[model samples]
Each structure stands twice: as structure tokens, then as C-alpha cells.
Target: MSRIGKMPIAIPAGVEVKVVGPKVSVKGPLGKMDWPLEEGLGAVVENGQLLVNRLSEDRNVRALHGLARAELSNIVLGVSKGYERSLEITGVGYKVALQGRTMSFNVGYINPVLFQIPAGIEVKVDKQTLINVKGFDKRLVGQVAANLRAIKPPDVYKQKGVRFMGEVLRKKEGKTGK
Candidate 1:
């Protein structure tokens, strides 16, 4: 038995979980999300908790057991409490602003870079340097933050660019003149 798959997911208040065939639907105060389970894996709710079970003991079936459980757990938690990712901008004039549904990144570029915000995800800017990406889907929230960070990943030499909040990077020293 898979350790993670054996663990039951606790359903918080105001959250509703439904298992329909291979699809799992989770709804809570934040939002609702639906996802299909992997083949040979099934889910059931009992005693206010959700459990993932495998139909067979094959190697592949065992592998998907934990994955299905984790995915379902993420969906439940996301809908109940939501998820957020924060990014910090470093370097002079490397700030961001939200214009309508787009993000304007001014990271020492001739023209500010632009990123369009997707539906179901919200972006909040604080004083132009800090950014908050929020949504009810953990994967989407993380993907959005990663895309924003890719705009100008941290510099190895100057350590300037967009990075996750509290991310530590070692600075590479420049070549010394002979």
C-alpha cells in the first residue's frame, strides 16, 4: 500500500467533495475545481474524509495511487483556502504595474514587457515591486508565478531580476582585471 494514498484527506467546513465516475469535483468558499482520476484509481468519501484506492496491485496502478490522492488533496485545499505565490523584483527601475488585465514589467528594458493575466487567477501589485498571484488552483497559481519569473530570471552576477519572495541566490563575482 502507498503511504500517501493510504492517508485520508480531511474535508474542511464549507467544502463539498463529489466523486462522479472517474471525475472528482471540489467546491468551497474560494472556488470549485474538477479533475479526472488516473486509470485504475478511484476515490470515495467516508467519515468526512476522502480516500484514494487502486483497483489492482499492478506496478503502474500502485504508482498512480499516490498521485491521485495528492492531486485530489491539492484540489480540495485549493478550493477551501485557495493558493498564492509572491514574487519580488530587484534592480533599479525593475518594477511592475497592472494595467487592466495585463502586467507591465519594467526590468531595465527599452520597452516594458507585457504579460496577460488569465481568467480565474488574480494578480496584485504592492508598491510596484512585490507581486502576489492568487487562485484556487495550486498548479495554475504556481505556473503563473513561474511564467512571471521567467520574464527576467535572477541574474547570476548582479542578482537582479524577478524571483520568488525570499529566494536566495548566490552572486557570481565578476572577472578581476589582471
Candidate 2:
């Protein structure tokens, strides 16, 4: 038995969990999320908690047991409390702005990069250099953040560009002239 899978997830207030066949839907104050159950794994809502069970002792099933539980827990938490990722621009003249559902980037480029914010996700800019990505789905929030960072990844020489908040970059030494 997996330790994480054996644990019960406590359903918080204002959060509703519904399990229908191979699909589980979690609805909360923030939003709603649904996940498809994997093979050989089962989920049940008992009392005020959610439980995950595996139908076999197979190694693959055991591995999926914990993964399914964690994914469900993330869905529950995401819908209830939400998720957010912050990024920092570290170059001169680099800036970001959020207008409506579009995020405009001016990172030392001739033409500003425009990223259309996807549905169910919110993007906010602060101090012209800080970006905050918020959403009810953990995976979407992270992927969006990664996509934004990929626009101008940090430079190895100056460590300049977009990076996750508190992320440390090791600067590379430039070549010396003889």
C-alpha cells in the first residue's frame, strides 16, 4: 500500500466532489476541475473525505495509486484556493504589461511579443517587471508560466531575462582578451 494513496483527502467547505464512473469532478468557490480516473484505480467519497483505492497489487497499479490521489488532491485544492506563479524580468528596458486578456512583452526586442491569455487563467503585471499567473488548474498555471518564461529565457552571461521569482541563475564568465 502506498503511503500517500492511503491518506484521505479532507473536503473543505464550499467544495463539492463528484465521482461518476471514471471521471471525478471537483467544484469549489474558485472554480471547477475534472480528472479521468486511470485503469485499476478507484475513488470514493465517504463522509467528508475522499479515498483512493487500487484494484490490484501490480507495481504499475501501485504507482498510479499515489499519482491519482495526488492529482485529485491538487484538483480539489486548485478549485478551492487556486494556484499562482510569479516571474521576474531581470534585464534593462525589459518590461511586461497586461491589457485585457493580452500580455505585451518588451524585452529588448525590436517587436514586442504579445501573448494571448488563455481562458480560466489570469495574468497580472506589477512594477512593469513582475508577472503573476493565477488559475484554478495547477498544471495550466505552471504551463502558462513556463511559456511566458520561454519568451526570453535568462541569459547565461548576464543572467538577464525572465525567471521565476526567487530563482537563482549562475552567471558565466566571459572570454578574456589576451
Candidate 3:
């Protein structure tokens, strides 16, 4: 038995969990999220806690048992408390601004890059260089942050560009003249 899968998830106050066949939906104060149950895995609500079970101990079932548990845990946490990712701009003249649902970036590019914020996610700029991405879905928040960082990834030589908050970059030495 998987250690993680064996543990039960305690549902918090004001949170509602619904299991319909192979689908589970979690709704809380923050928002609602749904996940499809993987094959050979089952979820049940008992005594105000969520439990995950597997049909058998097959190789594939064992692999999915832990994954399903983790995913379900994420869903419960997301709807209740939400998730967030922070990024920082590390170059001169680089800044970020939000106009409605679109975010414009001025990261040394000839033309400013405009990225539209998807529904259910919020982007906030602070001190013109710090970016905060918040959403109920952890995966979406992380993917959006990655997409923004990809716009101008940090350079090894200058260590300049967009980077996750607290992320450390190794600077490369430039060639010396003879």
C-alpha cells in the first residue's frame, strides 16, 4: 500500500466535496475545482474525510495511487486557500504593467510583449518589477508563471531578465582579451 494513498484527507470547514462516479468536485470559499479519477483508483467521503483506494496492487495501480492522492489533495487545497507564484524582473528598464486582463512587459524588447491573463487567474505588479500570479488551480498558476518567465529568461552572462522570486542564477565569465 502507498503511504500517501493510505492517508485520509480532512475536509475543512465551509468546504464541500462531491464524488460522482470517477469525478470529484471540491468547492470552498476561494473557488471550485474538479478532477477526473484515474483508472483503478477510487475516492470516497466518510466521516467528513476523503479517502483514496485502489482496485488492486497491480504495477500501474500502484503508480497511480500516489498520484491520485496528491492531485486530490491539491484540489482541496486550491479551492480552500488558493495558490500563488511570484516573479521578478532583473534587468534595467524592465517593468510590468497590467491593463485590465492583459499584462504588458518592457524587458529590453523592441516591442513590448503583451500577454492576456486567462480566466480564473489574477496577475498583480508591485514596484514595477515584481509580479504575483494567484489562482485557485495550482497547475494553471504555475504554467502561467512559466509562460511569463519564458518571455525573457535570465541570461547566463548578465543574469538579466525575468526570474522567479528568490531564484539564483549562476553568472558566466566573459572572454578576456589577450
Candidate 4:
């Protein structure tokens, strides 16, 4: 039995989980998410906990068992309490501002980058340097943040650009005259 798959996902209050055929739907205060399970994977609720089971011994089936369970758990939790990722800008004059759902980034560029925020995700700026990303879907939230950060990822030499809060930037030393 898969260790992670064997574990039951505790259903928190106000979160609803429904299993129908090969699909599982999770709904909570924040939003709703659904995913289709593999051919041999099944889900059931018992003792107020969600259980994931695999119907085959195939390597591929076993591999997806745990992964699917974990993703479902995260979805439940995310919908209940939501998810967030914080980012910070580090530079002398680099900063960001949100104007009516458009992100204006001034990262040492000739013109500011105007990014249109996608639906279901909220971006907030503070003090001209801090960025807060909030959403229900963990994957989408993180991917969007990564894309934004990639616009001008923190540099090793001077550590300028947008970066996750507390993320470490390895500094590089300049070559010396020999």
C-alpha cells in the first residue's frame, strides 16, 4: 500500500468533497475545484475522512495514487483557507504598483511593464516594494507569481528584481586584476 495513499484526509468543517464516477469535486468557502482520477483510482469518505484507493498494481497507477490524494487535500485546504505567496522587490529604485488590476513594474526598464492580472488571482502592492499574491488554486497562484518574478528575477551581483520573500540570492564576486 502506498504510505501517503493509505492516509486519510481529514475533512475540515465547511469543506465538501464529492466523488462521482471517475471524478472528484472539492468545494469550500473560497471556491470549488474538480479533477478526474485515473482509471484505477477511487475515492471514498469514511469516518469523516477521505480515503484514496488504487485498484491496480501497475507502477503508473501506484505513482498517481499518492500524488492525486495530496493534490485533492491541498485543494480542500486551499478552498477553506485560501493560499498566498508574498514577494519583495530589492533594488535602489525598482518597485511595483497595481493600477485597476494591471501591475506596473519599474524594474530598471526604459518603460514600465504593464501586466494584466488574470481572473481569480489578486495582486496587492505595499510601500512600493512588497507584493502579495492570493488565490485559491495553488498551481495557478504559484505559476503566475513565478512568471511575474521571472520578468526580472533577482540578480546575483546586485540582487535587484522581484523575488519571493526570504528567498536567498547567491552573490557573485567580480574578477580581480591578476
Candidate 5:
């Protein structure tokens, strides 16, 4: 009865999907992703589309029905088009630069913070502030972006730090002038 679960995920060209028992593996040009089916949840490939069905009427099974389907669909999409997150660095003299496999951040520290970029993920810096994080796996892409953002969360007063593009910061007013 879940609206999302009722929808079928289409298999695009150059993408191969396999359903083995409770595990689903999708191989695409970008990469391969695998996930296990939840209890009472069943999925199959039919007519070039992935169909998700619930084998039981339990509430928990029903709840996971749609979520599992959506997550699998996301994986398909990720392998096809990939995922990307943009972050902006704001502050005086605050910047980021990439050196081969490592990223250097100049965020108010005497020494730049160095972070090694993970495999399958690409990090690009522009104008020393705008950062673009990209990868085929949505989960990994998002996690890397979050880790980069957490390195220097935005300040309330100056709003100076790393933040996702389009993210709003609640700026605090400066002290009243005497």
C-alpha cells in the first residue's frame, strides 16, 4: 500500500542488476552497489524494472517496504549519474587546496589541516573557497561532504567557515557599539 514501493525502478542501459536471495547487486558504468533486502520485503526484476513487494502485512515490514525500494532506486540513479555536493568556504584567508591525494585547509590554524581524499570520490576546489565533492555512491559522497563541513562549522557571528551551498546560517548580531 506504500505509494513509493508501488513504483518500479527501471534498468538503464549499461547497468546490470542481480537479485540473489535477499541481496541485490547493481553494477553500472560508474560503480557497483549492493544491499540486502529487509525481512518480509521482497524485490525482483521484471520487464526491465525492479519491483519491490512485501511478503508480509506486518507494520514493520510495511514501513520498510517503501524505504528499501527508494534506497535501491537511489543506488541505481547514483551509478548512472553519480552524486555531487558543493560547499563554500567563507572567512578571511580561509581557503582549501588539493595536493595530489591530500586536501589542505587554511582555516585560522597556524598549519593547514590535511585530509586524505578517499578512493572513488573526487574533490575539486575553485577560487580557493567553492568546493565540489563528487562520487558514484550517494552515501559515501554525502559522508565525505559532511566530514569536510564538520572540519570548520560556520560561525554564528561572522558566518565564517565551511557550509553547503544554499545552506543558511543564523548570524548573531555583534555587540552594541558604546
Candidate 6:
């Protein structure tokens, strides 16, 4: 048995978790989200607490036990408290702008890199250098931030470009001229 999977998830007030066949749905003050359970895995809500159980002991099923519990836990937490990721821009001429649902990044590129915001996610830009990504889906929020960071990862030489808040990168020394 997986230690994490055996743990019960405490459902907060105004939050409801339901298991319908292979799908697990959560509704809370923030929003509602659903995900399908893996094969040979089952979930049940007991006395306001949700529990995940394995229906089979197959190799793959055993591997998914802990993962399923964690994902469900995140879903419950996200809908209730939500998740956020912050990004910082560092460079001489690197900045980001949001117009409507589109985000444009000017990271030393000839043309600004454009990104379209997906549904159920919110992004806020502060002073053109700080970006805060928020959503009820942890995975989606994280993926969006990673995508933005991928646009212009920090340079080891100049330590410029887009990166996560508090993310550290070692700077490299430049070659000296004779």
C-alpha cells in the first residue's frame, strides 16, 4: 500500500468531492474541476473526507496510487485555495505586456513573443517586469509559467531574460581580450 494514497483528504467547508465512475470531480468556492482516475484505481468520499483505494495490485496500478492521490489533493486544494506562479523579467530591454487575453513578450527579440491565455487562468503583469499567473488548476498554472519561461530562459553570461521569481542561476565569466 502506498503511504500517501492511504492518507485521507480532508474536504473543507463549501467544498464537495464526488466520484463518478472513473471521473473525480471537485466543487468549491473558487471553481469546479474534474479528472479521470487511472485504471484499477477507485476513490470514495467518506464523512466529508475523500479516500483513494486501489482496485488492483498491478504494477502500473501500484505506481499510480500515490500519483492519483496527489493529483486529487491538488484539485481539491486548487478549487478551494487556488494556485499561483510568479515570473520575473531581467534584461536591458526585456518586458511583457498584456492586451486583452494575449500576452506579448519583448525579450531582446526582433518581434515580441505572443502567448494566448487559456481559459480558467488569470495572469497579471506588474510594472512590465513581474508576472503573476493564477488559476484553480495547479498543472495548468505551472505549465503556463514554464511556457513563458521557455520563451527566454535566463542567460548564464548576462543573467538576462525571463525566469521564475527567486530562481537562481550561476553567471559565467566572459573571455578576456589580449
TM-score of each: 0.98, 0.96, 0.97, 0.96, 0.94, 0.96
lDDT of 3 by residue, 1-178 (tens): 9999999998989899999999999999989888998778899999999999998778999998988999899989888899999999988899999999999999998999999999999989999999999999999999999999999999999999999999998899999999
Query: What CA RMSD would candidate 4 show?
Result: 1.1
Q: What is the lDDT of residue 12 in candidate 5?
A: 95
Model 2: residues with Cα > 4 Å off, grouped in runs: none
Model 1: per-residue Cα lDDT over 1-178, one tens digit each: 9999999999999999999999999999998899898788889999999999988888999988988899889999999889999999999878999999999999988999999999999999999999999999999999999999999999999999999999999989999999
lDDT for each residue of candidate 6 in 4-74, tens digit (9 for 90 to 100): 99999999999988889999999999899998999899999999899999999999999999999999999
Give the alpha-carbon lDDT of every model: 0.94, 0.93, 0.93, 0.91, 0.93, 0.95
Estimate the lDDT of model 6: 0.95
Residue 92, model 1: lDDT of 87
Clashing pairs in 2: none
List where candidate 4 sits over 4 angstroms from the true fold.
none
Greater-TM-score candidate between 1 and 2:
1
Looking at model 3, residue 160 earns an lDDT score of 93
Clashing pairs in 6: none
Please identify model 5 stretches exceeding 4 Å from their true place: none
Alpha-carbon runs more than 4 Å astray in model 6? none
| For model 2, the run of ten residues with the poorest summed lDDT | 54-63
Model 1: CA > 4 A from native: none
* Best candidate, lDDT: 6
- RMSD (Å) of each candidate, 1 decimal: 0.8, 1.1, 1.0, 1.1, 1.3, 1.0
How does candidate 3 fare on TM-score? 0.97
lDDT of 4 by residue, 1-178 (tens): 8899888999999988999999999989999999899999999987878999998899999999999989988888889988999999989999888889899999999999988889989888999999999999999899989988998999988878899999987899877898
